[model samples]
Target: MPKYILFGDYCENALEKRTPYRQDHLEGLKQQKETGILVTIGPTKDNTKVFGIYDAENAEQVTELIENDPYWKNGIWTDYEIKEWIQAF
Candidate 1:
């Protein structure tokens, strides 16, 4: 499996409205974790940005998975960047 880093910022308005869908989004992420896809996820301490890492087969597959996220579907994240990552440590 290849590792990927997903970087993005949440939409201000959407973040305010995302509480209702948080559980669903978490459930989806939980499934991914069980499948060994999600490595870790969290928002920056300041809460201005969000980022996550995942182990997937490829970028396309990862992108597909991200597109299915409840947050993404609900417009919580309006912009994002996905890139292959190498963890040398």
Candidate 2:
């Protein structure tokens, strides 16, 4: 599997706007984590951005995962960019 990085910008007042969908969003993340696709994900401390690491077959898989997130559907995430990453430990 390949690894991908996700960089996303939050909508204006994302903290407040995200409340309605937060539970769904977290649940989805949990499910992804259990399936071993999501390595890690979280918002910036200031809540302006979101970052995620994913292990997937391809960029398309990661893209679909992000696009289907409740935050993305409801606009808590305004936009995002995905890039294949090389992880060197």
Candidate 3:
């Protein structure tokens, strides 16, 4: 498996809009966590961005995981990116 980083920028008013889908979003993360694909996930201190590290076979697989998230489907995440990560010792 390869490691990848995921980043998402919330839309304007995303905080208020995210309430309904928050639980679903969390459930999705839980599924990934159970599979051991999600490494770590959280919001930035400022709450403007969300980021996570995931272990998957490839970038496309990670992208699918992100695309299926409720936050992404419901437009809470206005924009996002997935980058293959290379951890340095």
TM-score to native of every candidate shown:
0.92, 0.98, 0.93
Report the lDDT of model 3 for residue 65: 88
> Model 2 TM-score?
0.98
- Model 3 scores a C-alpha lDDT of 0.90
Model 2 poorest 10 in a row by lDDT: 60-69
Looking at model 1, residue 1 earns an lDDT score of 81
On residues 1-89, what C-alpha lDDT tens digit does candidate 1 reach at each position? 88999998887765577898899999988999999999998887766577999998999988898898888898887778999999999
lDDT of 2: 0.95
What does candidate 2's lDDT look like per residue over 19-50, in tens digits? 99999999999999999999999989999999
Name the runs in model 2 displaced over 4 angstroms.
none
Candidate 3: pairs in clash: none
| Candidate 1 vs candidate 3, lDDT winner | 3
- Each prediction's Cα lDDT score? 0.87, 0.95, 0.90
TM-score of 3: 0.93
Local error of candidate 2 at residue 64 (angstroms): 0.6
